[model samples]
Every structure is written in C-alpha cells, then in structure tokens.
Target: MIIDFFSAGFDVFSSPLALILTFTGIIVGLVVGAMPGLGPLMGIILLLPVAIGLPAVAAMGFLIAIFVGGSCGGSISAILLRIPGTPLAAATLYDGYPLAQKGRASDAIGIAITSSAIGGLIGGIVLVFALPS
Candidate 1:
C-alpha cells in the first residue's frame, strides 16, 4: 500500500519532460535565490506562470527542485558578499564570510552548497523512511 504509493510517485520521473523541467528549475532557483530578499517561495511564485502550462508531474518536479536549489542558493550570497540572500542562510554568513575573506570564496561556496545538498538528502531520506512508519 505505502510502497505502491511511493513507487507511483517515483514513476513520475520516468518522463524526460519531468527531468528537464526539474533541472531547469534548479538553475532558475539558484539564480533567483542568490538575489537578496528572494527566497524559494518567491522563486516558485515568480515561476508559477511558466509552470502553468507544464504537465502536473513536471510542474511539481520543477517547483520542488526550485525549492531545494533555492534553499542552497542563499549560501552563495552569504559566501560571496557576506550578506545572506535569505534568512535561511544566516548561519552560512558567519563561516562563509571568513572563508571568502581568506581568498577561498570558491571553496566556501562549494562547501556551503555541498553541505546543503547532503543535508537535504538526509532530510528527505528521514522523511520518506523514518517518518512514514
């Protein structure tokens, strides 16, 4: 029962359209999220018009990807400018700024992004496996 639901949800990715949209959404999210004051929600809202024409699965995939990417994107600004792109990146600003000042801006950004990705992966796993049962 639960397994079937999970499988059905994963099945949406079988479509190439969903993959492409998701990828594009991530890029768009990264760009939008790097801008100060524009977080994941705003990125989704701004892009909703475009998503309107997409199929349901693709739209959801795109929006979800945007959210994930946006959440990580704020770290870019935090690392580069010492200013958090969003409140979610506030913690990043502390360590990220120091690294940036040390001529390791690239390294700081990489670490921030990688850590965010890993955190998201772990959170997703916990939600899917631990929380369900």
Candidate 2:
C-alpha cells in the first residue's frame, strides 16, 4: 500500500510540469533564503499556511523543503552576517564566521551553495529509487 502510494506519488512527480514546479520552488526558496531579513525560519514559517492547505504527500514534501531551503539559507546569515539562522548551521559558523570576518564570505557562501546542490542531487537520486516506476 505504501509502495503503491509511493508509485502513484512518483508518477505524478515525474511529469515535466511537476518537475518544473519543484525546481521553481527550490529556486524561490533559495532566493527567499538569500535575503537579509528573510532567513530560513522566517521563510518556512511564512509558507506554513500554504503547506497546511496542501494534500498529505504535498504537505510532507513542502515540509521536507523547509529543511532543504534552510540548509542554504541558514548558512547565508552565517556567511554574510556572522550569525547562524538555524542551530544546524552552528557548525557552518565555525569556519564561515571567520571566513566572512576575513573577507572570504563569498567563498564560504560558494561552498555552502555547492554543498546544497550536491545534497539536492543525492536526494533526487534517492527519490528516483525510492519510488517504483
């Protein structure tokens, strides 16, 4: 039954339009994360209303997205303002804060961006395997 759900879910997700929407969402999330006042927490919090209106699987995906976007957004403040937006980014601050203080904020941000992309790639692969085609 779960497998059936996953399969049905994956089938819906496999469409070009669905993929486009997902990618658009990721880009929008990252943009939201990049802003100074719009940190990851705020971004996710703001989206909560929309999440609640979604279906079960969509709501789950949207919530999963909060973390993914947060991973990128949390590091932004650490790299730009030397403040951690999320606790998970406390580790990011160890080197990122110093890097920013030393005028290496861009480098730190670049690394954070790359790590986020790699993670997304791995997640995409896992998602592909997790759902029966």
Candidate 3:
C-alpha cells in the first residue's frame, strides 16, 4: 500500500485538474477562514454542494485543502485584530498579536502558515494510516 501510494501520488499530482482543485480549495479555504466563527467545519459544510456535484476524490481533496489552509489563515485575524477567528486560533493571539504589535506581522504570519502546513501534513499521514485499521 505504501508503495502504491508513492506511485499513485506521482501520477495524481501530475494531473492539472487535481492541481486546480487543490489550489482552488486552498484559496476558498483561506477566504472562508478569515471570517470569525467560520471554521473549517463550517467551510466544509458550506461547500458540500460542490461535493455533491463532483467526484468523491476531488471533493475530499478540496475539503482537506480547505481544512489545511483555513486553519492557517485563521491566524491572520488573531495577529492583526487580536481576535480569535476560530477556536483553534485562540492560542495564536497570544504570540501572534505580540509579533504584530512589534511590526513583525508578516513574519509571524509566515511562521504560522509554515507551521500549519507541517502540522496538517502530520495529521494527514496519521489519518491515512488510521483509516483502514
């Protein structure tokens, strides 16, 4: 299965539509996430209509993409406005707002985004292995 995954991933990633869906999902996620109280669950639920009309794989990719980007994007409000955009982002305000106040908002945001991506990757890996077992 692991070997199959690497091979399949290479091919799947080469497809333009997959890339588009992923990109679109990330953008949609970031936009939706910026709204306070509209977390990944809400974003996914709101976009469920798209899933209904699309292939299951594409829909799931989009939903996960949103979850990844949305979680990261929520930090923007936490830093810039000192408001916890989502429950998960409440912790971000502690250091995020301080960095913003120090005029390092961009750096803080960059770190937050990078960290979120790493965290998401870990979560995905764990989810993948856990799903079938």
lDDT score, residue 66, model 2? 58
lDDT of each: 0.90, 0.71, 0.83
For model 1, what is the C-alpha lDDT against the true structure? 0.90
Per residue, candidate 2 scores C-alpha lDDT tens digits across 1-64 of 6679778878866766445545655665666665655656676688778777766556556656
Provide the TM-score for each candidate, comma-separated.
0.92, 0.62, 0.85
* Model 2's TM-score against the true structure: 0.62
Residue 35 CA displacement from its true place in model 2, Å: 7.3
lDDT of 3 at 103: 95
| Tens-digit lDDT string for candidate 1 (1-133) | 8789889988867799999999999998898889999999999999999999999999999999999889889989988998898889999999999999999999999998889889888998888787644
- Rank candidates by lDDT, best first: 1, 3, 2
The alpha-carbon lDDT assigned to residue 74 of candidate 2 equals 72
What's the CA error at residue 127 for candidate 1, in Å? 0.6
> Highest lDDT among the candidates is held by which one?
1
Show the colliding residue pairs in model 3: none
Higher-ranked by TM-score: 1 or 3:
1
